[model samples]
Target: MKRNIAVVWGGYSSEIVVSAKSMAGICSFLDEEKYNIYKIRITKEKWTVEVGGYVYTVDKNDFSYICPISDQRIYFDFAYIIIHGTPGEDGRLQGYFDMLGIPYSTCGMMASALTMNKFICNNFLKNFGIRVADSLYLNKDTKYNLRGIEEKLKFPLFVKPNTGGSSFATTKVKAVDQLQQAIDAAFGETPDVIIESFISGREVTCGCYKTKDKEVVFPITEVVTPNEFFDYEAKYEGQVEEITPARISGEMTDEIQRLTRKVYDLVGAKGLIRVDFIISDNQPFLLEVNTVPGMTQTSFIPQQIAAAGLDIKEVLTEIIENEFNAI
Candidate 1:
């Protein structure tokens, strides 16, 4: 029997386009013969699925839908969440699926919620001996001390939405005068924001996923961007160069893979995730953990999977089947 798989996309954030692209990429990677795939598009308005050339509404009661033509109800066996922001990446969708006894392809509720907040997640990992850049957190109602921030941290800080992704409103502040404007820009996207001391060095990322049978950690990728930083444009606009099997020492690759596994276990992450880092003074500083990483063909995970000489189709199958085996 073929299992029904929901490639859930769209969210209550600006990353909807990225999520849509990821949905297409995932659908292409999954083995069509083994699973009955459906493109489940979600938004603030409604939850829907496209059947044939017509769109049908999905029942939120049990995550099933009735085929008007056949008068048959179709239920999803699993959910492959690809939303990059709120309701999906922040754990809301995971909690919903958990209550319904439906497995998903991402971190659990706690892990998703914990990792969505950059400030809290980094601080939590810091306690586990994870090296992270010094950072400060701020909310829309809180009063931040700019002078204190400057004194405690170095110049050229990164101002970003504490709970946002796709570098939507992230900014690099090189001077005190640019601080206020950067903060405003980040606040425009999210109510809470973070300011972190910039780490200067080569930037690299590693993707990993652990199933019940195997621990797969992909090759590292170096991020080279001409912009001030790896901003929104660089990530989705093809303005950056992502070099796979990063031109680093073999020892460095081992260290990164070790840290990647450690972080995955520490965060209780499920499915595939990408951990970003900046090597300064030969030490890898944790940047941020992406629970619902981009799965587009050009995304880092696909690139790394190819670099590792593994078949993407088999990789997706392993992850999907792992969920059923765990249950």
Candidate 2:
């Protein structure tokens, strides 16, 4: 019997565009003969499934819907969450799935919540001896002291929404005069903003996932962008060069892979996750952990999987089956 799988995508954030691309990539990679795939589109307006030019509404009560053609109630056995932002990325959707006793393809509620907020996640990891850049966290209600901020962190700081992704409303401030404007821009995305001192070095990212039987860590990818940083344009607009099996020493690559595994275990993460880092003076500094990393054909995870000489369909099968095996 084929299990019904709901590939959930879209969110209430700007990353929804990226999510659409990931949705396409995931649907293409999934094994059609083994499982029944349903494309669930989530938006601020509705949760629906469109099939053969017909649309059916999802029953949020059970995460299901009535098949338009067969007039039969279809319930999803598993949910492949590809939504890049809340309520999918921030644990809200995880809580809903938990209530329905449905398995998903991302981190659980606690890990998702912790990682969505970059400020808290990085600080929490810092206590575990993960090297991170100095940063300050601020909320909309908090009174920020510009002079104190400048005194603590040097120039060329990065200002970004503490709770979102896809580099939306993220800015690089090279001077104290540009700091306020950057923070304001970030605030437009979320109520909380994070200001971190820049790390001048090579930017690299690694992807990993572990099952009960084995751990799989992918090849590291070096990101070289002529832009100020790896912003939205560089990530999705083909403005960046991504080199897999990064041009680094063998020892450094091994250490990075080791740290990637450690971080995955630390956060109790499930499914595919990516960790970004910056190497400065031969030391790797943790940037942020992506629990619901992008799965687009051009995204980092797929690229890393290819470099590892692994099949995407096999990887997806392993992830989906791992959840069932655990139960």
Candidate 3:
């Protein structure tokens, strides 16, 4: 029997369109023989599932939708969530799926909620001896204290929302003059903001996957954005240059892989995850881990998978198959 897999995408997040695009890429490459695919769009009120040339818009409140085939209701064997930010990445949708007793890819509620907040997540991991950049958290309630923050971290700081992806409101401030403007831009994205000491080094990302037996780490990829920094446009606008198997020494590669596995285990992540890092002075500093990394063709995960000489379809299929065994 072909297992029903719901590729859930589109949410009330800023990355809705990007999520939809990722779903399209995933659906296109998924093997048709092993599983039945459903491109499900998650809106405020309904869960629209599309499969086998038919569409069913189901009321999420009641879990009722028009059956494509017979009158019987359809339940998915697994939900492959592709939503990048907001509710999807923030654990709301994961909790909903948990209530429905459905298996989904990525971290659970606690980890998702924790990691979604960049400042909190980094600090939490720092307790594990992970070296994260020095950061200060800002919110609407707090007064703007630039001098205090500057005392702790020097100029050329990175300011971004506490919870967002694709660098939606990320800014790199070179001096004190740009501090307020950077804070305002980050605040525009979310009520919470994070200002961190900038590390001048290569930007690298490593992808990790958990199988039934062992954890696998893909090659690290260095990101070179045309922009001064890897901002929102550089991420989604096809202007950044990414090099797989980053031109680092074998020792650096091994160290990064070890750190990636450590972080994955620390966060209790399952299925697929991507960990971002900054390499400075021959040391890899932990940046953040992405539980639900983008699955588009241009995404870093796909590039790493290809660089590892594995087929993307096979990797994704393995992830779905391992969902039941993942803790």
| Number of the top lDDT candidate | 1
TM-score of each: 0.98, 0.98, 0.94
Q: When superposed on Cα atoms, how far off is each prediction in RMSD?
A: 1.0, 0.9, 1.9
Candidate 1 segments whose C-alpha is farther than 4 A from its true place: none
Clashing pairs in 2: none
Range of the 10 consecutive residues with the lowest summed lDDT in candidate 1: 145-154
Model 3 lDDT tens row, 1-327: 898788889877677878987898888778889988888888776678776677778657534456845877876878888888878888998998888888887788888898889999999989988889999999999886788778888987899989988788788888888899889988888889999998889899999998887667999999898698888788888788899989889999999999999988888887789999999999889888899898887889889999999998988888888876653
Candidates in descending lDDT order: 1, 2, 3
RMSD of 2: 0.9
lDDT of 1: 0.94
lDDT (0 to 1) per candidate: 0.94, 0.93, 0.85
Location of the lowest summed lDDT over 10 successive residues in candidate 3:
59-68
Number of colliding residue pairs in model 2: 0
Which residue pairs collide, candidate 1?
none
